[model samples]
Target: MAYFDQMGCKKRKRGERVFKFKTFGEQGHPVEFKGSFRQNVKSLLAFGNLGNSLCGGLASWSFQLEVHRNPPEHILLFVVEEPIEVSLNRHCKHCLHVGWGNHMICNKKYHFLVSSKETVATCFGYYEGNCNESYSGTAGKFNLVEFQGHVMHGVFHSNGFGHLLCINGVEMGSDLAGYQIMEFWDRLCTGLQARKVSLTDNSRKRSMDLRLLYGVAYSEPWFGRWGYKFGRGSFGVTQQMYRKAIQAIQNIPLCLLAQQFGNSSHDIPSMFSRYQTLSGHFLITLRDLLRFMLELKACLPSENGSIDTYHSGVLVDTTCRWSPKRVEMATRVIVEALKKAEFRWVSRQEVRDAARAYIGDTGLLDFVLKSLGNHVVGNYLVHRCLNPVTKVLEYCLEDISNGFFPSQEGSVTNDSELRTRYKITRAQLLKDMFCLYSHFLQEQKSMMNTGIFATTSLASRVILNSKYLIKEYCGKLPSLIQVGLGENSDVYCTIRVSHDGEVDEGRRKVIVPHECFMLRNNTTFNELMLEAEKSFKEIYFGLRNFSIKSIANLNAEGTDLVFKVVKVGGELVFEGSAGENGLNDEDVLEGFRRDSVVDCPCGAKYDDGERMVSCDVCEVWQHTWCVGIPDAAEIPSIYVCGRCEKDILEFPSLP
Candidate 1:
């Protein structure tokens, strides 16, 4: 016979008959056999006695294998520490433990027999649905030794309840085989602290099936005969339950982690370490739940119309009224939180300044003030000089005044007709109103301490200058007329009056005839002369005449060169020329002869065949038609020439 060890078979012999035997050992460690087969076999069988004695009546045994063969045979042996009941059953003569022997029947020897106490578990049946069939099991018993180990005792409770059954010492059960091995280990560790460990292979699979139900119920509560129920304050029990389930999963080793670190059978240390971090995983899940709750709350309807669930909770009536006060409150809360957080705080003044800057020159402050209505804040601002309404009014009036009547000259004449037509008074009421409002704003609270009024004044001056230029060229009238000016019209002329009551007419003096001067007609020559004289006097009121060294006559005829003779140094002197080129020219002499047939100054006949007559003195002939003369028949006498007549008058004694 050959002694069987944990590894395989070992050679053995007795006396003259050689025997082969096989042996088994604990956990696969080889057991050494000494001496003959009968001696070692007896010793190996006695090894169970030592375990039984040490366990104090609790059954214990050792695994042993022996094999017998022909001459020159080999003996195989194996040893293991097991319960005494397994050893007794294997050696009992009348027991059906023949399969537990280490000897092979033919060429093959028995590897090892599973102790009767080892549990045998296998998948029985699976349910079909949305749930994973790998997780579900049916009520039925089946031989499972091929899958795991042999079953010791099995029984089905009443009505398929309490299906608990113990197997051999090995922890093989349906719970262990129901799900993947990794998942099985995961669920095994979840409720480990409660001492309610489920060693069955179906533990993980059953939990997974339960989790599927949880998921389905969470999504469609009515599908599982459950009514819809929202959680208090936006957090629901279903969400919590889901979180718990995830937490349970995290308690197990992640498949990737396990594959990397665990061994083929079991790796308790690494699994324990992974399970220790379950609290952190739970915290992460909690954070995710909180985020989900916040998102849900944000999407929920508040003061707005109820949400329409028909289209997956879309808001149909979007015309919801939001409370400004509530919005402000919420904003304040957020701001406070932000301030308290690890960041900087933004001041209210800074925000206001930012808003003001954003508005730029749009005058939004005025708009805000105007829209404030009769609120307490509005009233307070009005009392405190911070009133935007008053400020806008002041700005508007100032703009109008500065943009209309600008200079004293243009202001008086522009829009004179419109002023009259509209029956408007030229009083500075608009300007005064703006000034009073500005004064009120400044004196009440001094909101602008940097002399904004001065800036306004400067801007007003610029505007006034611009308006004056526009009125001057375009002939547009000012909004208001001056006191003495007529209505705005083209007939009006702007005349500047000096401190001495003299008017300025550009390079000359000009006096206003009357406010209604443009309304008059049929002016006489005397009246024209008097008006011209008055205009000149008014224009050159205090101007002194420039000293003239000599007076030169321009190319003109007749009295065009009138002489004002004066004896500056006791001498007879004429300031102008004589004869036709001077004051006493032929043209002047011709005016004196009404009907006289005067010869031309070039000594030509009055009636020349070529429409031209010759002058006798200067010898220059000009045609009567060319000279614009009416008729020669209108002359009384044709006697003296033009130049001869002038010479006779200039020097009468010599003539």
Candidate 2:
């Protein structure tokens, strides 16, 4: 207290960015809290009852932080605290070394946060998504962290950043919607020592995603105020960048006398970045970096636009007059074209060329196409990106199984487009994303239902209505580009995979253009196997996995030098790889739907690790449930499934 008071500590004013409070501590504890911010904290009342691990050693975890999610509309915002247990998945054991930590199954995931009342609840749903166990390995962590109950729940990486996966309840118009969210978010970020939260809006129209459907003070515009959403291929101010710059600049000695010059203000970005402050509580902003220390001023728009100070934020407010009804009326015009499209996915150009006959207004035509997100309405579903190599396509996620995906729904063909480097551009993709966002606005102004929505868009109203945050965000995300959508294209390369045995097989070289679209690194063992299937048919016989290595770096071992080369432009085609596959109950994943020979009465395969039994009469395998039995129930000495019993019983009855 004596230190801060003498050093110019003061109460935070109404609009100023700088503020200091009374009270101080040794700062040795993991999560030290001062009394002032206590009122804003949310308490996890049943933390003790939940009984989670304190310092971790119970099992293993990649990370140990809290997660917050926006549940679908039907889910209750506040419910009685439900019991949440965590566990690990044995099937996922192979990935433990790779950073896919303990999953939530057999009580392996519940590790409680201590005395911090901010941890009042512990109700994250069925399983953990991201790697929350040991930090060494990363599973490109994307986990389904369902909220069992409570406003905020779930365990995430303690040292990881906050990810706002979805935006819900905001349109419901509750003042507390944004308040509770911010409270939980702030607590999560503060505890994790994270600088900013990352949230992306990927709504492609059709399904009425909440990112759209709100106005002036709600929806995406609302989040705009607190955070800056950069444009295409943009990034935020990161500690990694600062550390890199500091490492580079530290070699140059500080020019102490240079600070005395009249031009010190311009040197602040350099000065603030160069020196590390003695105080541990404060966070430096981009604004602070540019005109921070020298001006002796506080942080201030960062504008929520770009990572740098020069660029401004972007806001999209489109006025669309389109709706489900309009598309229906123009059915003969649009549906006819969609039906005749060649590929499973239709491109925007294909759409324009097809609908040009009946659609008179160019803007209206464009809006109709853009608004048709990858979701199934009455006739068509908005299908997007396609993969030619894998023959797998992404349909409007809103309704992948809307009775129409690969199959036709009544009249409209299940259409998607191949986003090969030749067809789609980064600029076009970014433009279309915002264009679909505008679709929400265009919902035939009358259909916007703003009159009733006046009561909705809850969170945004709460955030702006009451200047809860002093440095309010400017209701705009100037940059709305998806990640990995850069100008960089795939290069033609040669990959030589050698078989282990010395007799028949030796090595086969796959000389193909490295793919740019696949989520995994350009080339992988499975990909090489698939590409060289004709050449290495015997090697890839049943479920044989291979070790892949780049011919260029064939000799590089597990030394740090190889890592350095890979970090730079150097490509390290590691032996082999994989990702966290979701727990699909029915066991059939359309994404991995290759040809299969499982003859179950129930038209499902991909087992997802469900129990299966052999039918004694026919010698065919069937899922326990499909043949009238429990998964854990004991099997009969001589079991006969319904399929086999049907014919035998019918034959006896006929005789």
Candidate 3:
């Protein structure tokens, strides 16, 4: 009988089948059959031929098979490709022999043979006999082989098309199932170097390319599948993994194009240029800020020396203290000197010398000191007189020199109480004397150049101008007319012409002798003028005292004289005398009484019979009678009366 298979093909071929039979004998010898021949022997011979092919020729086939008494109710065929083969060797009697291809043989009887495709070497089925010693009688039909260090199992199957094997028994249709098998084979063949396989050696590489092409071709379905697995709802499960994968891909090198040719020098120059530009701009801005701060410091009011507790105390109780304006002026002078030395075009040493000379000149120093008691700059004024050299002693010398003095418009009330409280230093008094001499010279010059005066007026103007210039430039003035004057008194004189170029009738006249007296007076005039000039030089350069007696004896014959005397207390007493004889006691006494009534020493008021005593240090006045002193035979030349003497001793000198 012939059977029909599922593909509509006859399972047997008539008259073409052959059969061969064999029987086992002792020692595995072939034995002839004892049964008689049947009429259907060709069918039996065909079955025997099929069985022989299954046992021997099937060893080279890439398929696994199993024979059972009953066929399986359901059959599933799988296809696989195998690159390596395993077979049993029949040369050994007691042992199963294994070799590649058809060289394998076995001693024990086996009912089935298993084979697999070169690509699909893994298979699974049931076996009835142990064909090889290592194969159990009931083993699963599969080929197990070791390649490198990894073990690979293969299985084969028969489908309608042909026999196929499953590598590692993995289903080929499953996702990544093909990759799994190829990776296993790859690991076995190459070990770690398998990852470096190129297209030449790796069929998997071609497969991977085909898969990628297919994925792109069916992008919709693949993307749909991917989205279903890793959509927004599923992102929590794979976000970190996906991000890592992207980062790895980005870090991987795609080509070596950049290594061969890359331009970085172009960027380097630009980067450095930008950095230098920004750095230079920053430095310039910093310099400008420093300059601005320095200029600001210049504009602020500053003081010399740090403020100490004493300075703070004086500032707080300013009414009895020297005004801050004086201190500020001193500070300005110091600061200006420093600035000139530092910034002026002139040499520093030259600037320093000029500053010192300007400050040291008695006339200029006196003007600055006097301006301390008046507003000479800005909104501030010095309301109290300060001793520039002593620093501590101050005075309110408010007796304004009214007749022939440097004048400004404003008047300040004399603070008698303050004057009594403060005393001027000797240096300050000398400075004031120098300033006054300059003022007198200025007045005499104005008088002489007016030219409205006659011979006498001209003479007087010339005399006054000469005397004042001598005193100012050489630093002293002399007195010619004196019968009696205080020990500390020095006379300064200024003679002015009448507006009509004549001696005014209303003015007091000086008596003069006729004829011979005039000649003698001319001689006296020459001698006294010379002596006055000499005395100026002695006082200025030698620092000597200009005595009233020495100046009075300059002329022996009669001469007209006008005297303005500064008593020890800085008071001015004026007297005029034109004389053939020297001033009589009565004239001297009368002039003294008139000037002395208002405290001839300091222009301070005196109580009845309160004779003023003069300070030898500053030549200023205090009341002798009020100070509890009896009259002395003569006022001591070096006597600073008690109060001023005490003040001088107490006040410290400037550094």
* Best lDDT among the predictions, by candidate number: 2
* TM-score for candidate 1: 0.12
| Alpha-carbon runs more than 4 Å astray in model 3 | 1-238, 244-248, 251-655
- Model 3 lDDT tens row, 1-655: 0111231122224543221111111111122221111111111222222311112223222111121214411111121222112234212211100101111111112111112232122222112223343434323333333121111232211100010112322332222233433443232212111101111111122122211112122221111221211111011113244333323222322112112113533222222111111121111121222222223233334433211111100121345243555444442453344344432233323433555654554443344344433221211122343356655434222222221112223222123442332233333323332332232112235443443212223322222211100001011111122322433222332221122234334332321100001112123333434444333322121112222222222323224432222122122111222222333222211112223222333233422223456665555556554445566755556665655667778998889
lDDT of 2 by residue, 1-655 (tens): 1221222123213342211111111121222422111111112211112212222213212211222123211111221211122233222221121112121111112221211111122212111321266433322232223322223332322112123434322333222354445444444444333322344443223343332222221222234445533211111112233233322222222232123222534333222222212111121232122122212211221323211111001111344355534554453455456656633555556667767777776776665555444433322334556557655433222222222112223443222331121132333333433442332122324454354222222222222222111111111111111223343222222233333322112112121112111123344434533443322221121112333333344454332232222331233232221112312211211112223224665454323234567777766666676667885789777888776777887785554
State the lDDT at 599 in candidate 3. Answer: 33
Candidate 3 contains a number of clashing pairs equal to: 37
Best by TM-score: 2
lDDT: which is higher, 1 or 2?
2
RMSD of each: 60.6, 27.7, 67.8
Residue-level lDDT of model 1, residues 1-655, one tens digit each, is: 1112221221112222222122132211232432222222334445332222212223233333222233232321112232222222222111101111111111100111222212201111211121242312321222221233432222111101011122332134322222222232222112111111111111112112222222222331111222212111001113344344333322322333233234545442232221111111111221232223223333544523232111100111334343334322332322223234323323333333444543443343333333322211100111112335444221010111121111122211124443332221212222322332233111223343334334333322221111100001111221122222333111222222222222222212221111111212233223322333333233221111111112222222222212222111111111111112222111111112223242443333332223444454544545454444556644222333455667879885753
Q: CA lDDT of 144 in candidate 1?
A: 25
Q: In model 2, how large is the Cα lDDT of residue 74?
A: 15
In model 1, what is the error at residue 420, expressed in angstroms? 91
State the lDDT at 216 in candidate 3: 20
Off by over 4 Å in 1: 1-117, 120-208, 211-655
Q: Residue 310: error of model 2 in Å? A: 37
Worst 10 residues of 2 by lDDT: 307-316
